[model samples]
Target chain A: MEPLLSILIGVLVAGAVYLMLARSLMRFLFGLILLSNAANLAIFVSGRMTAGAPPLVPDGMDVPPEVVANALPQALVLTAIVIGFGLFAFALILAVRAFRSLGTLNTDDMRVAEPKEKG
Target chain B: MSWYLSLPLILPFATAIICYLLRDRPSGAWVSVAGSALGLVAAIVLMALVLQNGVVAGQMGEWPAPFGITLVADLLSAVMVLITAITALAVAIYALSDVDARHGQLGYHALFQILIAGVTGAFLTGDLFNLYVWFEVMLIASFGLLVLHGGKEQIDGGVKYVALNLISTILFLTGIGLLYGQTGTLNFADLAVKVDAVENKALLTVIAMLFMVAFSVKAAAFPLFFWLPAAYHTPSFAVSAVFAGLLTKVGVYALMRTFTLVFDHDVGYTHTILLWVACFTMVTGVLGAAAQSDFRKILSFHIISQIGYMILGLAIYTPLAIVGAVFYLVHHIIVKANLFLIAGISQRLTGGSDVFKIGGLYKSSPFLAVLFLIPAFSLAGFPPLSGFWAKYIIVKASLDESLWIVAFIALAVGLMTIYSMTKIWAEAFWKDHPDGIDPKLSALPGRTALLVPVIGLALLTMVIGLMPEPFVTFAERSAAQLLDPTEYITTVLGPEAMQAADPLEVAP
Candidate 1:
């Protein structure tokens, strides 16, 4: 389980990094999505490859039993997933707007927005 | 009374809902101002409340920390929010007549309020991932506002801004993910308790770098700051004012919070990187400012340069340095916003912010000149003004750290900053214009100018610089908050880490 999780994280990292280096804004968005997924997986796997832990204290005790699939990671991952979705949506919309206006999704095409008065 | 914890989040969200419902109606402009004014008042009251009560926090949706979202308000958060609210209010009033009519001022107002709400949210949120959410909320609204009057330049600028920010968000998300994976917690307080419990410090170092990259991008630090100068001047003065005032500081604040609290001493590699980056950022930003011919553009570059100060303080990692950074952030926010306002007014008179094109402004409008001079000298770190105290604290802190090289760099930066301010003065106020050029009222805005608040902000800057004991005390307490995250973690997780963090708390 640990080895399989590591492989998945590696693949996720590769795909996200590749997307990140792309020239197009859409690709950039995809890159971000890929990166976030990779992170979420890393977070998930970092909890030691748990098969199942509902995160609730078993038998509803005050101090959660030491053996619950580490509810903390799951909670963190949940928050991360929601935030990732928001970021993805925002980026997606921004990409659409840029393409619509700039007539190209290529990052290389976007330039000259600086203070022209400054050299 | 404890529920006032939610007002900062609730108010702007309510305003956002109203904004979407109203769309582009001019009345929406009125709504935005009313909402921000209320927020400003709430924020001030909150500040007063904190002053009286020390710190106040409450869990959201009635969930205890560790299991639910939390909002914590201490001196640091309150001060940042107060500055943000005041700037938002000033800009809201400024937008009425000064803005483009096509958006009816309301559309811009809507985004402006959301941006404020998001910034306030970022500062107040006790959870790390929730901070990411507020950042996105801000990014989307800022994107909308940046293009509210999309000309060729604005479209171009917005593209870069949106692109880089999206990348940063991804980086931030990934960092959160990695952090959660390693510690099995996302709540900052919860994570604080457990992250240090990790057996492998190297993996923790990697996670820390991830968060640093994310925040640095937002803060406009050296390599990551490339997007800022290129895009800052694209929007109108009122828009630029709030953007300049509150946005980047959110990143700086996050850096201060995360490094001091969550990462603690696990930031070895990152600290070296930050120190070098801070110096380079200052030098390059000042150079960028020196080379600029436009007023706003110069200020924009200086934003990067001055950000180095905040980063430098944090990198050095001292209590006094932290105080300096806090002081610098407040001073820079007020001065930067007002400088943008002055640029807007200058253009209103001259149709340009370019020094070469517009001249003899000293004779045209003495009030404008006076307005420009306050922030100008203040920014240049002139004595007896708010800007001086900020620079003094930072330089002194660096010297005490026995960081002679850094202290020298800071002094050089100060001199360079003065040179840039004087250049603007010479070009706009001292030089002569063409024979046929007629100087006019620069459209003295209106009831919307809200001159009282502008004066209040300026006076506040002065008071902060002069009678600064309260602010310094607050800043020190705030800085200490980072040293002892037991309160923060406990505040969020509801004593989950209280007994556990006892030893950790005592050591700091």
Candidate 2:
């Protein structure tokens, strides 16, 4: 199950990278989202995948039973999810503002701002 | 009330809520001012305890290590928090009216307080993943501050800054994930105990590179520093003042922590890379500064160069070098922030920080001139300023490491720093003003609120420079504590839980 999840996340990451290489600004943004999620899934899967079992300790447990799926990765993933949300929000705002200000969301049209500034 | 380790983290949070709820009231300014002063007191107490106790740590929720969030105040961390608190307090007072004028009173104070909270959090957090979260918090607040006025250049420059930082964040998070999977814990002390026991040296190497790359981007080291110069000079004086002071040093401090505590064995490979990179980073950054005609632009480039000195010490991995890195970081944080405030004052003097257009600032603002001159000399490593001691320590450490090439590189960077300082002085203070003065911009008084902090920092620079014994002794003691992880880990966790297995047993 761990190997299977790894392979699936690997393919998702590869797809994300490929999308990131595309020309449109929106496609690039999508690429970032996909790549981050793939990474999150990898983090979730790497702690030895146990399908359908939530990570909690029983009442009689001395410590978290080894049988419990790890909670650390889940906490890390939750943090990542919120941070990813922040990144996506900030990126979307930038994209929308870029569209409004530059009159295009295509990367190709964003080239003219750096031409030698007239003194 | 005695929880100095926690107050830097708490006050700003409470103030943020206060600033948010109290909408547009001048009371927010007073709240910010009071909170920062109180935070400063907390930081000083933390500093005292750190100096006395070596490393002071408390686990939140009264849980043990690796199970709860721990806040550790060591010498280096405490000094950083001290400098951060000082700058934040100064910038808070300085920004009061300016913030009101910008009508971003609520958001400004909120973000400003949050930025300090994040810096303080970064300084004190003993967990690697928590550091990333704090970095993000600071970055988000900085992004808001940078683009708040909604200018086109800010929007444009901010996009690049955001893009680059997001990539670095991913890299940092990815490294933390890799580290957690391997070691099963995120606490620094626990990681220190278990890192050598981790199965694969190669895996650790990869993760170390990921961390190095992430911190380099934040610290604005060499190739990764392109975004900093692209955006830093474009922000308002208040925003620039804070970022210039606190942002990159957070990265430098993290680099020191992670390298020593998590990846000490990989120093050989990293040393080789950081040496060449530090040399180039210092040289190229200074040259970039030399190329720039603007006041703040040159200083922004110098920031990248100064960061190289800090990295140079870490890369060398000697006790002296590490101590030097700590000293250099504190010195640079104070002087750099103070310089930005000087630029802020200059803008009021002649209506701009652009050296090409503005001049003869000395005539109008003699006090500002004196203020700028002190930090400038300190930055240039002139005798009797904290800057000189910082450089002296790094140079001394480089010599101790027997790296003549690195020592030479450091000396040459020092000279270039002087050149940059003189350029700002000559252009902004000495040269004649072309526009005479812009009536509207020059009409506004350069407020005393701003000058007071700059003066405080200037006095500190002089005091530290003239008498380097206490700081160096403290830094050395701090470095000694860091080099011996047993002292730190034992203090944080009870000695029994983290006692390493007998080395003799491992040898067989």
Candidate 3:
């Protein structure tokens, strides 16, 4: 299970890097989404997937019983996912705005901020 | 139990929410100013506490360290928070006159406040995961502020900034994950102890490199600083000023904290790489600045260069060198932000920011030119200025370590910085306006709000320069604290926890 998850993360990262290198802003957005998922999975796999009960306290005790799942990585991942969602949403909107205002998505052509001039 | 640590974090957030609620009204910007003032007061109190107590730690929700979120302020963190608050107040005041009604109505003040909150949070957080969260908070708010006005140049700059920063975020998260997997702890103090016990020394170095790359991108170090010059010149002057002052320094701060406190196990490899990065960053950044003809673009490039000096201090990894880094951090924030603010005023006075297009400021507005000269010369490392002392200490430290090549680059960069400053002076202030217009300061509206902060910050640069004794002593003490993390660990994780740790894992 761990090896399979590792392979999945590796593939996702490869795909993300490829898309991110493309000139189009839309492709870059796709790359970001894929990369974020890869990060999430990497964190999940690092915690060591074990077959055990859910990370819940049996009602009436202060701490969970022994042999439960590792809860810290899950909380970290959930937070990362939510924050990543917000950032991607903002990035997508920025891409759309760039398209509308700058009239091109090509990274090379988006030179309005940095106009080339002969010295 | 120390509430002072929480005040810096809470005040900005409170300002952010209140400013957002009142975004549509004219009073929103005023609310931001008031909130920043209060935040500055809180930071001063926190700094006083840390100066007296040496190290202060507080755990949230009553959970002990290693289990709950920890807020720790050593001398480094305290001074950083204090500097953040100072820049926030300066930028907040400048925003009143610079941020027009249209931008203000679009929640500019709210986003600015939130960015401050994020920066303060980053400085105060002791947990690794919490630091990542603070980076996100700062990133989101800066993205909003960068594109708020929505011009073609702004959107173009914003896209690149967002894309590159997202990649850095992912890399940082990945590093966090791998480090946790190796050590099974996310607390900084615990990681310092546990990382030593890991049998795989090679793997630890690899993880350390991963963190270095992630943070270098944030610090705008060499080969990773393309996103900064691309975007920084496009935002409003106030936005650019705060971004110039605080954002990249957050990256540099993270590098200093982690490298000194946690990643000291393999300093030979890690610090060597940092030293090379620091040299190239200095050379490349200055060269980048010399090529630019615009006002803000040149300043933006110089930010990359100044960052190199700070990193060089860290790379040297000696007590005096770390003191130089600490001193450089505080001094650069003031001078760089003041330079940007001065650029905004010059733009308002002349109707353009391109040096070729506007001129005659020496005759028309000598006051503004004097203000510009103070920061510009200080940035170029003139005697009796803040930058001079910062450069002197770092170069002296390098010479002490027998790093002749590094010392030469440090001095040579100072000379080149002076050259760049002269180019700006000759074209922007001395030469006659190509269009034959006299750019006068009186023409700028709300001149008090704009001029006050510039004057105030310029005065600060002078004070830090003239009275270098106290500041240098503070930097020395901070450097000593950084070199020996015993006080930090004991404060955060308790005295018994330090005793229970393995001796081999303790920092040398």
Candidate 4:
């Protein structure tokens, strides 16, 4: 399972890099979304796979029982997922705003802030 | 003492809330002002505590070390936080005059305060993951602030800025995950102890490169800094001033921290690469600045170049070099932010930021010209200013290590820096205004609020320049602490933990 997840993360990252290299801002944003998910998946898989019970401890136990799953990575992945969601949401809105304001999503054409040649 | 560690983080956040709630009222701006003043006081208290006691560490929520998140302040963190507070106060006051009512009502102060909180948290955090969280906090707030006043330029710049920074953030996260997988710890002190135990030194170096690339982008190093000059000059001057001052330095600080603390295993391989990167970053950044004619855009590129100097200090990796890096860090923040504020005033006075188009400040407002000269000359590494000593120490350290080429690059970059600074001084201050109107200090409404921070920061530059002995000694102590983190580790993880994990078990 861990190996399979790692492969998935690699593919996602490859696709993200491809899209991110495109001229269109929308493609770049899609790349960002995929890249963030790849990061989340990477975090998820870095914690080794465990086919044991939930990580919660039983009553009166100081810690979880032996052979329990690792909970810390799951928590980290969840936090990453939420933060990624908010960021991607903002990125999408920003993309739309950029399109509306700048009249194009092509990064080459969106050179209003930094014109190619100084006047 | 614990409160000292947490107050800097809390006060900005609390201010952000109050300012957000009062965003519609004029009081929102004042709330930001008050919040930053309080933050300054809090930072001073923290600095005093660190001065009294060498390294201060506290576990949040009463959790023990390596288990709960830690907030630790050594001398370096203390100084960074102190500088952050000072820049925040200056920018907040500048915003009082510069931020228009529409921008104020748009929650600009809230985002600004949140950015401060994020920067302070990054400086203070002891856990690696908490640092990522703080980076996110800073990123989101900065994104909002970057595009606050909706313009075609702002939106265009903001898109590139957010896209690149988010990519860096993801890479940073992946590094954190891989590091945790290997060592089973996220706390800096714990990782410093356990990283040596990890077999496969090659894998550790790979992880270190991941952190390096991620942080380099954040620092706006060569080949990855296009987003900075593009986006930074698009924002309002107050916003860009704070961004110019504090944001990239945070990246430099992270690089120094991780390299010194956890990734010291392979300096020959890692710092060598950093050495080349630092030199190119300096050359390219200054050359880029020379090509720019706009006021803020030129400053933006210079930010990258100065960042290279700090990284040079890190790459050289001597106690004296690290002292140069620490001193450069504080000095750069004050000087860079003041330059941006002066640019803001220039825009207000002459009604534009194009140095080629505006001029004649020497005739009408010699005071403003004088104010600008201090930081400009200091930035150019002239005698009797902060930049000279900073460049002198780093170059001297490099020469002492027989890194003659690196020293030459440092000096050449300083000369190029002077060229860029003089370009601004000649066109913007000395030459006559293209239009016949006089650009005077009194032309700007609310000139006092704007001029006060500039003058105050200029005075700081003068004091740091004339009295370099104490500052150098302080940086020397900070560098000593960086090179030897045993005191830091014991403070964070307790004496028992330090005993269990023998300090002498590591290879140099």
Poorly placed runs, candidate 4 (over 4 Å): A117-119, B501-508
When 1 and 4 are scored with TM-score, the better candidate is 4
List lDDT for all candidates, in order.
0.78, 0.81, 0.92, 0.92
Residue A73 accuracy (lDDT) in model 3: 91
Docking class of 2: acceptable
In every candidate, how many clashes are there?
6, 0, 0, 0
**Per-chain TM-score (chain B), model 1:** 0.95
Which tens-of-lDDT digit does each residue in B290-380 have in candidate 3? 9999999999999999999999999999999999999999999999999999999999988899988889999999999999999999999
Scored against the native two-chain complex, candidate 4 gets a DockQ of 0.56
Q: Model 2 clash tally?
A: 0
Which tens-of-lDDT digit does each residue in B1-508 have in candidate 2?
1266788899889988887666577687778888899889888888888777678888877777878888887787899999998998888888864565444553788888898999999999989888988998899988888877666767766776877788788778878877877777788988888787777889889889989999999989988998888888877887888898899889888988888777887777977787777778888898999988878889999999988888888887788877888888888888888898878877766777678889877776666778888988888788888888888888988888688888898888889888988888888887778888632323556466767788888888888888899888877887887777777787676687466732211100
Residue B153, model 3: Cα distance from true site in angstroms: 0.2
Would you give me the overall lDDT of model 4?
Answer: 0.92
Clashing residue pairs found in predicted model 2? none
lDDT by residue for model 2 (A1-119), tens? 76787788788878878987876778878888887887788677655555454766679876655555567788889999998898789888987887777677666555432234459
TM-score of each: 0.91, 0.94, 0.98, 0.98
Q: Give me the displacement of residue B254 in model 1, in angstroms.
A: 0.4
Ten-residue stretch with the least lDDT total in model 3 chain B: B499-508
Task: List clashing residue pairs in candidate 1.
Answer: A43-B181, A72-B184, A73-B184, B65-B492, B65-B493, B189-B489
Cα-based lDDT at residue A5, candidate 3: 94
Error of 2 at B35 (Å): 0.7
Best by DockQ: 4
